[model samples]
Target: MFFAGTVKTMLPKVPSTSGKMDIIRPLAYVREKDIINFMKHNEIQAMSCGCPIEAGKVDSKRKEIKILLQELETKNPNIKQSIFNAMKNINLDYVLGYTSGNKSKG
Candidate 1:
């Protein structure tokens, strides 16, 4: 993965995982000022990597879900405790395949 932008760019922070190696191996961390050098040093070869795009989509969906949750809370303020209880009981590790050192035991 090539992160090419200024530090203030809206790029999301890299996520942590339980795997032995990083899921997204950063090829280079390029700043805006070093863009020219970065382009020169890296060869333009594309295989098939949809991680960045998919990550963005997932991030957007998460934001949308957060908004919906906020709306639900606002509309049903009395059920806040129940919602919290439900969320606490839900375990997503196996569902998202991040259980047991990044392998799902389900």
Candidate 2:
């Protein structure tokens, strides 16, 4: 992935899982397939910290996070509680830790 010039003038490719940009990231280099997925996950984790549960979606700010988590969990049982706990989570430090490398938290 690469971004040149100012953010306004730059066009970029997806970063690897480590968030490192490259000039031409082959499929082998991208451990996460796409970087947008990382952005989405980060956004979701942030939203999870700032909302309340409601019918089918979060009631406070972002609904996309809740919907995405639901869809992800429905497809993967192991990831179910990650989203479940994110709803009740009130600590940014904990969520940031989970979003990083520690696998068990999420």
Candidate 3:
């Protein structure tokens, strides 16, 4: 995928997902500066952190995040906790020496 003056342009071709790859691989190379400039120039709101649990339509994702944050804030009035909850989760699956056992399990 590539960007062209405030527009994310993708080649008119089928995406590839062969071999061991589950997601389709993008071929074009769009510079990060170009994308950032485009977004800034066009006044784009927020960028998606690309979460797996994101569902529904493209516009709905932002709304869902806002709703979740509001609910969390209502439950717990701590600003730090709200910010912590908003941050993207770190995937611990591939982390070395990390286990899911409690103190008793040891």
Candidate 4:
């Protein structure tokens, strides 16, 4: 009886109850149509980005925009249109503001 008790104690314990299950909290999935609408509202290409990060005197502002665009794309592959649109807007903004020895007002 002692050997049997020792063996029993060595076994892992489990809950006797049934019907206990794990629940997962999921993020709300954005729809493609909603993503397109967001792009229209933001005046950006749905998947557009103008910033590229490079070593040696890299522009931090451009890097930031690039990171934001990357995050948006990584988080929602369904929003490719919005990503592209945002990129187009970035290019337009740059073109309108960029000039030699002159600061274009936003």
**lDDT over C-alpha atoms for residue 78 of model 1:** 49
Give the TM-score comparing model 1 with the true structure, all chains together.
0.26
lDDT accuracy of residue 81 in candidate 1: 63
Clashes of 4: 21
Record all residue pairs in model 1 with backbone atoms less than 3 Å apart, i.e. clashing: none
List residue ranges in candidate 1 displaced over 4 A: 1-59, 78-80, 88-106
Q: lDDT of candidate 2 vs native?
A: 0.47
TM-score of predicted structure 3 = 0.24
For candidate 3, list the clashing residue pairs, or say none.
none
Tens digit of lDDT per residue, candidate 2, span 1-106? 0223211211135456587655443443342325558868677432343424544354543356556656886788657456445555657564433332354353
The list of candidate 2 runs beyond 4 A from truth reads 1-61, 83-106
The per-residue C-alpha lDDT of model 2 at residue 61 equals: 34
Worst 10 residues of 2 by lDDT: 1-10
Residues 34-94 of candidate 4 have per-residue lDDT tens digits of: 7778879988764434535354255675467556766887878756567445544655344
TM-score per candidate: 0.26, 0.21, 0.24, 0.24
lDDT of each: 0.50, 0.47, 0.50, 0.50
Q: Which model is ahead, 1 or 3, in terms of TM-score?
A: 1
Task: Kindly list the per-residue Cα lDDT of model 1 for residues 2-95, writing each as its tens digit.
Answer: 2332112222344456555444535334433366565668964345567764445456554665567678878787454675455457566534
State residue 4's C-alpha deviation in candidate 4, in Å: 78
In candidate 3 the C-alpha lDDT for residue 67 amounts to 71
C-alpha lDDT (0 to 100) for residue 43 of candidate 4: 86
Per-residue lDDT tens digits of candidate 3, residues 1-106?
A: 0222221224335445564534433523454457788889999966566764564336564566567666876777675344444333545454343334352221
